[model samples]
Target chain A: MKQVVVHPERCVGCMQCQVACAVAHSEAKQLVPAQFESPRPRPRIHVGAGPYNEGFPNRCRHCDPAPCLLACLPGAITRVAETATVMINVDTCINCASCAMACPFGVIRYHEDRSAQAGKTVAVKCDNCLARQREDGIPACVEACLSAALTFETLDAAYKRQTDAVARSVSAVAAAEALAPGWALLNAHKKARLELLTSPAPSDEKRAAGNAREDTHVRHD
Target chain B: MQYVIIGNGIAGVNAAEAIRRMDPNGRIVMIGDEAFPPYCRPMISMVLEGSVPLAKLPIRQASFYDDCKIEPILGNRVTELDVDAGRVDVNGKHVAYDKLLIASGADPRPIRAEGLELGNIVYMRTEAHVRRMLDALDGGARRALVLGGGLVGFKAAYGLMCRGLAVTMLIRSGYPLSMQVDAFAGGMILDTLTAHGLDVRVDIAAEVFEGKDTVEAARLSDGSRLDCDLVVIGKGVLPALDFVPRDRIEVDLGLVVDPFLQTSAPNVFAAGDAAESIDVARQARWVNAIWPEAAAQGKVAGINMAGRTVPYERSLSRNVIRIFDLDVMTAGVVDPQVITGAEVITRFDPATRHYRQLVFQEDRLVGMTLVNAIEQGGVLMALIQNRIPVAGRRERLLAPGFNYRALA
Candidate 1:
């Protein structure tokens, strides 16, 4: 199944995805009119300013054996196997922050949502855009992402593409045949500027090991 | 392989499900005192508050045991345990098992007060107890007196007020939720409750109760008499490990368990409120009896019992309470004043009505208490639980708009 895969390196700190998400979930599926809707349709996807002042889009992973699902107080959270989506029953939710305490990624938010009964507040998070998928439309965030930071693809296909990029980046004709060369160069410059400003070496060291965008820059020194 | 699990709580239920997933052909026997379908224990307070209906409590159906193909024994607690023989005696029945799980959760800690054997006085712990309280409430319980300022007491007080009952709460501590939140946060919660019609008495205990059949009044420690018809005890809980032979098994406040959730006895394991695991934040053996911990511990324990070696690590004490207009979340050591070299950073935005208190041991976040704007509490708590060092300007964590990008 095609799911929204985030490529953070490709993000240019543009919050267009946030605007698109709010509109998609709004009673009126348009930007200008969604602003006027009661309760003001909020975006499920949150884009934060990254460590290097880049864009880091944060959304629910829809983790199997989801921590939020298990930590739910009223048993309001459940896993829908078809979309691999973890959903919250707004009616059953007691508005207790039990799910908030258990969510390690801090993706869940609480507020008065349109789906909640009688303007009641509920715990809200990414639902994999199941409503859009049902209508044969891709997720609004992916559609609005002009930079291709967000894409709709299967996990296997994403892994295959990333794996190929890693192989090609280290090859004999590496620089000319790099994957997303513009994005790779942009993040590299951000990292360099950040290193000169900060004194600590440990966070950078940990980031170097965990970051996948560093495939092009293998600095042994 | 034969598996026997004690208690029908989340811990035991999850363990049974875990064991069945690994060893599908294993003979599983589940013994529980509550005959009702496996329900969410934490939502009992919601039921008391009248926010959640009684039907919404059960997490599973009546056919859960049959669906799992397990033997079910209900309405009975284990009378005794023969650890050496690997048998549990309940209602004169000897249930033998190769693998044993003591997931019997905690019970409400009893208090000593006169006229204890009266009607209308109850403890808010089990669904049955909550049902009894509901019966009193349905019986037109107008004036209610509550003891203790802990989670149980606070919830009961909140529930009664919602039901239009005049509630007078007595707390042994300076403020409510003393165990869960710090002085500042506790005061905020107390003020909210007070505004919502909760008559609170601090540093006081019920010395004596005077009533005919049902409790009518209580003499407090401060030499004052309080008149009330309904009474609820919100004192905290202690582990329900009565059947275990402490001489053979190493027992602290709760049953001592290894990283694998296995007890000292052969083929015996424990989880949930009954087991004490190492606290990731405090770096000590502590029983985090919350529902989330119990659920996590059960899965780990079941996997280990099913022959897979899964270590149960990173047990942290955490709680999030939603009071009227306030969302308070706390984790690990919120009170770090006594700890040497503890650096505390706090911020309160009067404009946004958000408050954040971050306690640090060096660069690593040891504890935190978030008042409002607590959406990112889990991210902050993960740093504490994993002992991850904070890299950026630490003050950024106290910001109302803090997110994962700040750490990047």
Candidate 2:
């Protein structure tokens, strides 16, 4: 059972996964055709700019004891036992954002979907690309990700690999393993630049005035 | 073990299911006032508004009791509960129990007025009441008069409005859902309802019903007579704990339950609308009678009843409502005046019509009211629930694009 794993540090917020996601869920299933499709397909995954302007990929964890499932008023949300995917029945969904309030990760979105009843809007979310998976394909988001930020692998395999890397990093005799050295360096540079620009004292009043709303807004593209 | 559970609501049903998972051989006898299978209680409002059919209310299948191997005593209310003797009297029969759960839920608080037995006047609490309202609608109900500023009354008024009826809501507060949300957020909700042509009368209530066999009009408290065909009272609900012996079992606003969801009496427990436990945000005794709380409490109660000492966590007061174009989510102590040292921050983006009002007691997020953009509400709610320190992160939460990463 391979599932999508998130590696936030490697993400550059290019939004290629968002484009690929919309195309994958669209009627024509292509980038150019998806734009012209009625009730345009939307991405289920979101990329949030972290506090220090680092890219952070956000999506549903498909929790075993999902809060959204329990808090659902119409009982529209359910879990697929095989894939461990939380699926929403759009027909039964009342367009009530109860699931959004229950979802701690803030993954679920409400919009008019093409697969749903014509013009009726409903709660839409990630289905783990079950249709694509059935055809022996990976999730659209993972396939579109160029930075290896999102990968498809078994949870145990991912955990074991991470554990081995962490153990080796702590060993005194062995050289530490930096998983994505280039990405790590890039993120550290961005964070340091952000810290320096915003931490100006009273003497730097001109810089402070320009950077007042610098940390206020960060678009989740 | 003979397990006697009261009420077939979500709480009782979840408790029964939990106990079945642990004790397969226990003789579970569930006594419920509602004869129908366990249905989502909150969806009764949807049923009222004609969005969801009455048939679609059941949360469980027809073979629920059979599958769980539990004996069900339906269409009966608990007449008396003898905690000392470990017995329950429902429909003139003493059903014994080794471990008892009082998940009897709550009933709509009755209002005092003339013509109390009027035919068309109803409380939108039970499925049967909604059925009665539907029948009235089918019988050519035109004008509706709703009382109360609470969720029930507000929902009833909204439901009637959705059905293309002329609705006049009489609220005894500054705005609707006053208890659930703050004044500013309440005003936003009130605006949406009004924009949809819902006639709202603030600080007003119905004094008397004037009609022959069915309600035709209501005499207002402000000395005004209004024409109405149906009357729905949503003045809120009281705990259905009349049967409990207060002398033996401690009772507050609801039945007082311990951390393990057990009552003061041994071998007895209470959950759902009837259980009063410590409130996480308020940090005091409070009854969060919502469905999700009931489900969580019942699971814990059943687990503890099955011989595992699983302590139930402090309950949070929360509600999320999607009314018209507005989505409102509120939790905990929303009223700032109630808390002496509480600091309140409100940010309204008029362009998008999104609002965020957060109440804080020192570094902890005590309560929150969100309008429109509320996808990340659960994150803020978790912060409040866990009593996490939000020293410099308060402004970040008020931002419209706030998400889980914002907290990090």
Candidate 3:
């Protein structure tokens, strides 16, 4: 099944994902207007600054083995048949706070008294803007990320990349301190901004580099 | 049988059309309290910027009613409803109906403070509200004290900003839209508003509206006074259910309705800002006062009223607005400390003032907030709704200009 995989090493944590998700659900059907109209503009995803989390934009992993799906009492959360992504059915959500309570990552939130459904509160969490994809073929958050930090992937490939990302993060901390002293010591917010300017560029393979060189015109003096 | 619908707003207009589509043989009569034709309620703010003329706000043409063979009685309101006898009193005349719809949408909450009813003071709901606001603008109302920082409050503030009026939003809450978005996003929004040169103060309630014959100023709860030529009260709308029996049908933000948009009483239907429809996401029955929800609910209510037995699907309590050229959108619940285990990820570009965040549990996306960079709003929205798995490509999902087909 496809799922969201984050490369925190590549993350500048620009927060485009959250705005994109909110806009995806916005009434104005666009971002700028949605931001203005949203009172408590429920953002499904959250971008936080912490020593433990660093610059990664957090979202549901959509596990092959799901915990939240099993915990939901009213069966509000479900796995889409096509994408194997876990989704919430607003119709089925009872807002019992069961699945929300059981969530290990604290993804599900109870939209208590502000909704139209009685005894049924909206659970605020990321469905990955699936509605947009079904119609437009691209998720809002995924398309909006500028640092190439957030991405979509299957389980096996994600695990490998995540493992590699952790490794890179560990080394990058050292490299970052060396390249720019006192940078690694900076807090999450400062680090995120610095990462925006200093993060390593996407590695180019040999074939791509060869293609780029061929495209470059030579100036003979 | 004659069917009477109250209100010429989105809900009432759509209800008329829905009734025509269902019960073509039945006589459809629409009663509106406003003089203007049915218009998009959300577009009212656009009028402040002169982006749309007062005449263009109507959702449909004048011939719409004529084509549908519907009789629309404008500039009249039904103050009394005789549900037992199935009749409504409008302009001293009783209109009979076999099935009556109480689509009398809520009016903007009026400021009870003294001197608030002056020519300058206005509630931004109808065309008249806009007309008064424009007149005041022409009268050189240099400053505006907007009461309440809710959707309407913010919209008015933005509109006033567009009009080059020094605007200050006074809210009783700790922050603007504290109930809808998280503190971080809210802070970002506050910053955006502040950056636009509007003064926004939260946790300071309006104790009283102080002015002479006309609105001149407002006194705050924090012992501060705001001097302005205009004052707007946008404390939200209360359902216009004065005619209905209080004990028979319960009302809490609005008229309580079942999943099918049916009222507590059998054969009686309710929709629009007046009815409490189910919030499919939050799974609670609360009154959603937005335009799209009202229109969609009205259509569903009409279909079901015609013996179609169609179920009303609650939409995600969604709102989107524009501040200058910046795009901002929010969805789902955003209460603080509500999320315990969910991993929060934020991407902020202070230089560009762009922010995007996604909240996830395990691997699935459940909520999001977007600001500035909103073109990909559809993509992330789909992922949240579809809960698309981001396992391998979670990193790619955050990449700028990622291939669309790859995600699919």
Candidate 4:
């Protein structure tokens, strides 16, 4: 599942990330004008209340299959093929706000005024500072973050983390077997028997964790 | 009230001009550290490149100051400023002021390395710098080594190249102008310099100078050495704030000024390189050391000093450069971290070695790096300056063909 992993414990609540976001959206490439001239700059990635009193920022979790991407009737949101980062197209946004409503994370916002040419409200959200990341090593928010709270990791990196977790599980099994070889064999047999007694589980994580021998037995049958 | 202005660079002259407009009858006294009049610091690169002559580099004629009824105090060093007395001592002579503006800009960072006091070693900042280098060049100096790859170093290298000297630029970073542009853009600049027969090295520092009186050669970190007759150290400048106290004023990388360009002391102001104004767009105080911003800021300082309550607000860090033929421009907060996601429009023809990149974070143009396509710089700058909300996906701005309707 593709998602953003936020550690609110790391957030200092500097709101430099917010200022960076506003600058990303602003025409002047800065946050100018009196505070009253514009709306309190809406940041797509918000530094929400700290989780577990950790005190950090939050944004779209990008659910397994993002509900916001699914709910967009105008097709303004698309995942980048290279990095799978979600990008929002301003022109295609009809201001239906269905995406905003569907976003479980509430990451999307519609502009108050439509761009002159598009004549339709534009949708704003984080694009991962794609250009800057491609040019520089880090994204603007991550670069500007004095606390070093935010980061961007590749999909391969996430896959590695899960796979490493699985390796640890396998190593744990090996350690249990070393302590009592005969007992370990008996436990494997007991696990195989339990699989036969219970109905096939649906959760993929559990299924991946299940004995491979059971699948072999089913295939033979 | 007599307004006494010290220093005569872009910042000082700009303040003088602004004060003349704000208080026509107010006796304005302008003191300059340099003998020459106000000129653009940004043009120093062009000056070294020989594109602009020394005479033409000045923004206004010396007569312009006299025409405005501003007394020009040239070649005088301001020894002290008595904050309590509201007076400045120039060459031990006291000049009283109802208000004092300190625009004494920074000097080139001194070279602490041994043999730096030699005849051929130079630091490019004023006309004397160019004249000194030219004097050596006239004396048949053949090889030149520039110590930094920033704007100053690059310009110095370019100028030396114009004089038919073999030029080499040494940088401690991986690429040139790494502080301003990205690696890709920096590489493009390197290509331009190399194409012009200039040797550029990154990740290398000037380890040692080999000569005694007039420097002869330089040894690099890689154990390689280059023969050099002239050395121009373009190391960055540190703000000259010796006259001001730390407690009375805030000092970050530059002096901390409020939106009004006022220091902590009342009736005391600062402008140009010395004052660190807030980059209004970023909502952060940063040193805007560029030329146009310095001029605009000096004007604002003057306006405020003349009893106009105009709080100077808008500050966008903008700079455009044409290295060889590559047009590079970046404005506002051009940090890599801000670009969360972006769409790029690129047109690269390998045969010509030309490249153009317009980086958009979502639909807005947050940062851009361009090479060869010099003309598009203005349009992208306009988008950044206008804060133009992009209409479509970022790809629209970066189409295969040029369509400037996005600018409109």
Against the hidden reference, what TM-scores do the models get? 0.93, 0.95, 0.62, 0.61
- Highest TM-score: which candidate? 2
True contacts kept of each: 0.52, 0.48, 0.00, 0.00
iRMSD per prediction, in order: 10.8, 6.2, 17.2, 23.7
Residue B59 of candidate 2: its Cα lDDT?
86
Q: How far out, in Å, is residue B325 in model 4?
A: 3.0
Give the Å error, residue B405, model 4: 5.4
Off by over 4 Å in 1: A169-181, A184-221, B337-340
What does chain B score (TM) in every candidate? 0.98, 0.98, 0.89, 0.89
Candidate 1 lDDT, B1-408, residue by residue in tens: 999999889999999999999998999999998999999998899899898898999998789999988899999999999988999999889999999999999999999988889999999889999999999988878999999899899989998998999999999888999888887788889889999889998788998899888888889888899888899998999999898888999999999999999999989999999999998877789999888899989989999999999998879989888778888999988888646688887766655567778888888898888898888788888788888879876766765554665775
State each model's CA lDDT, in order: 0.86, 0.86, 0.66, 0.65
TM-score of chain A of 2: 0.88
Candidate 2 docking quality: incorrect, acceptable, medium or high: acceptable
List, residue by residue over B294-313, the lDDT tens digit for candidate 3: 76677777777777888875
Best model number under DockQ: 2
- After TM-score superposition, the amount by which residue A66's alpha carbon in candidate 1 deviates from its true location, in angstroms, is 1.2
lDDT of 1: 0.86
Worst 10 residues of 3 chain A by lDDT: A206-215
* B177 Cα displacement, candidate 3 (Å): 2.8
Clashing residue pairs in candidate 2, if any? none
Ranking by TM-score: 2, 1, 3, 4
Off by over 4 Å in 2: A172-175, A201-221
